[model samples]
Target: MSVTLAVNCYERTYRQVLAPGYFPAIEQMNARTFEQVIALINNVGDPREAQDRAAALVDCGEITGFEFVSDWVPAALQHWRLGHRHFRRRPYLLDYGLVMPLVSSSEYILGWDAETVLEEPADWVSPSLDLLGSDSRVLHASLNWPPARPQDAGVEGDAVARVGDFLLSWGFSDQVFLISRKNMLATDMKTFSPAAIARHAPHPYTFEFRMESYQRASRKVRATYEPVRYRTNLQIDGVLDRTGKSQYEGFRTEALHRVEYHITRQLPSRLGPRWARNASISQARGTKQG
Candidate 1:
């Protein structure tokens, strides 16, 4: 299979939260995480040696290409200024992510966030791709479903079952999945329509769009899920200390708190009418809103 990995690298957006005065420290953290991901990609094989076998999917011919997608500097700045009001709140979600398969020549594409690193030698993508072999009914399959907070585990499971046809999770913790160009087109992944973007403004950048698309697709297709191989460590963006729980975890927690406290509580008002600024206000409450 001609498989490609499309990674969404939003370095500019990573540092967008830092005001001009906070550039020195914030830039360093951003650069560090960026370099760390690059290094992880390089060291994917070295740590385990793969028993002298092909270590990376790249080496084994499972993933034939790597496309690093990001917005241009001008566009990034405008989007930052425009915030979440213009098109989609998280433009990178659709711009750098969902659009990958549509633009690629490869038959299969593994969409991933830059923060997600590969630590295992298993050909996760190829196996998932093989599972869908010649089965046009299978629309997409999740590569991993990382655990959510212990307390909310039950709620999460219920939500997954509720939307089993169109899976949803607490954002990034469960988004990694493998998809085909055919499925992408079938789900209308190319153009993120303005009306749809407005309706999903609150959680625009997450997998909700894809899930909804799948749900809306022909009823004959099926979606599959798999246990996560790992939680996939996060690169703490702006913290200097790496001795304990990641700063990324801290950042993610805070963001989720605000989402729960602000967005969820006020979804009616937050996503009121046609992409209101109230939602923008909720989205811009302190810590980075990636």
Candidate 2:
């Protein structure tokens, strides 16, 4: 059965409080108390006033404990920590606050074109892609690795190609971009240990790929292709290490790896003149390319 809650409550509690920068903590409460708290927060006009009221409930034993939400923490750090926990076990109820929206929106795209899905551990690709249904097409997939691979020639290309071939077997004609650093430097590592060497290396490149699927020429070919345009950003960036030494002392940085696949589907043929014109243009291009 699908979980259902009041829309306003979900937005205020989950989306607002649990959003990046805020850490939401709630004490144990029964259904009635939970609803009351939600109502109280909803009635308040100022964010700080709402927080203060919620804290008051804790002091009165109406709620056991609660933390006023604050945006002091970085979203990347929270996502990274949550990612570690997600891999260890099933996602917690709070984690659903983030996952549900992602899954829901991807499932909702019926027309108009363009959708992006980001996965942390490459393992999420299959399950997330499975939810896209048959109408959407994956344009590209990227895999990132720390600069710890053996210095063998063509290893990166070979690894990426193997993954590309695997995706092809899954009926996707998507391309794969592999990003990894080369020529490791001694200064990049804190120790000579294998684990440290592997963990501390930075990414070598950043790239973005966009793919568009156009209608086919013949009726037979048209049945196989969808009118959609997709754009994907697969890149790496330097992230500040919050636990590292202060700025005055010299801050530490780490690589933030991301894999995003975007899917865009065109409107049905009967939608409007605009779609009809675009489809015709796309078909001509497809025929010429073919």
Candidate 3:
């Protein structure tokens, strides 16, 4: 018999809490630009005709280059808006969710930042396999895309190798420090749990990445580097359990056998250590209580 997967569609928003001041300034600029573009869209007698005229102007070379301040904003916004609308209405709906199971295990990729690799002393840098590998100094990757399924059995070393290769191909990580896996599910699909969703919600602020700049030393010069820290807030708006017929009125029966991946980067990490630590801790505490 075909297996059933309880697919959850989530909306994720990344809020940058701690970063260089310039980052927020740039965000404000972008927001203002977006508002101007929306005003232009509203001013047109016919938005479609305006888009057609813009395209024709481009084809005739009347509009040759973009001016970030004004010229290209309308076209870019309209293009993205229309393209996303078209994608949502398509039959395949792969962008909406996964149709086949892409990941069967939960794993994390850990390593040192490039700055540490290039500048820090070898002894000062700790490998991820060490007891203190989970230290704050280590870089932990966030796996948000292609949401992973819960593995019921311990992941083998070979399986980790394969998953590591997959992550590399997708530009997720360059190095793997350690692989941590757990058998959390007892069956293929579990009943929808609101408690589970609530438990997975993000905390106020978490480290995202560190920015660094380096200057090489010459014959009469000295080497120097500067580091800037950044933290992120993951806001989970809501979740839709598409597997239930009653909950999802238009649920497709054919979708039962297929697992949805929810390719949109909007889906938060369900597997990696950075995000799943709270859930794992709760599970451990629950096991002790039992």
Candidate 4:
């Protein structure tokens, strides 16, 4: 059976919360390579994109090519003028969702364009997706295209294009996002009595899980990350026979399954009881893309 991923599309942009001084520099850095921009953003004392944005003010007339942070850039704007802004851009999808049995078990692929692709049909999928490793997490990758830019061409394009191609080729988004629910036995579920249900003790402050066999495509990059999930589950309220484990298993199999994904996903959230009220967006359930 094809596994349905818990989440499908993912996207991101230069959010202000991720940076403040970014507004002004946006114009200057717009002239340099995106790599140079990212380098400056990574150099802040606090390592936050906000501080690194300070470098954006370095226009052409102010600084020369020699003053960049050890090959980070050509001082954004040169002394000559804004110099045609050469922004390095790649493909990116703004929205997508997934249908997974559980948040943690869900997996989705992210294909960032690489500097190049093999002359022969090699393991592009392996190279692009291995970033997720075995552990689940949302991946928004940036592929490298090269031969050093104009000199030579690289992978087909950005992560977005590759992902779109995969989707088109597969005719569906199932395999890319695989999902499986972890069965929890009713016997194992120690439910508090109805009397204490409303005010039950908090879910003791703690959550940890062990990961095994985590792997990426190449060069062994070891990293750990928790995956994204949704808070959707079919609520069942009825007495259980508990007479036999097999019967219980059968019951679970027959019951409907509730799906979940990220917060911005299709469904809706209460969010303090005052959001999206009186709006179609709030009342809708599971918005789908044609």
Estimate TM-scores for all models.
0.45, 0.19, 0.20, 0.16
Candidate 2: tens digits of C-alpha lDDT, residues 179-265: 111100001111122111112222111000001111111110111111111233334222112223334323222321111111011
- The numbered model that scores best in lDDT is 1
Worst lDDT window (10 residues) for model 3?
210-219
Write one digit per residue (lDDT tens) for candidate 1, span 1-290.
76554444333322221122222232232222111111012113132342122224344433333333332323533433433333343444444443454446767755554344433424445445555574443455553444444454422341322122233222222235566766665453332322223334434444455444333222222233333343444434322132243556457556655654554435553442122212222222222111
For candidate 2, give the lDDT.
0.23
Q: The CA-based lDDT of model 1 is what?
A: 0.38
Off by over 4 Å in 2: 1-103, 107-140, 143-197, 200-237, 241-290
Ordered list by TM-score, greatest first: 1, 3, 2, 4
Ranking by lDDT: 1, 2, 4, 3
Best by TM-score: 1
Compared with the true structure, all predictions reach lDDT values of 0.38, 0.23, 0.20, 0.21
Candidate 1: pairs in clash:
none
How displaced is residue 268 in candidate 4, in Å?
3.3
Worst 10 residues of 1 by lDDT: 34-43
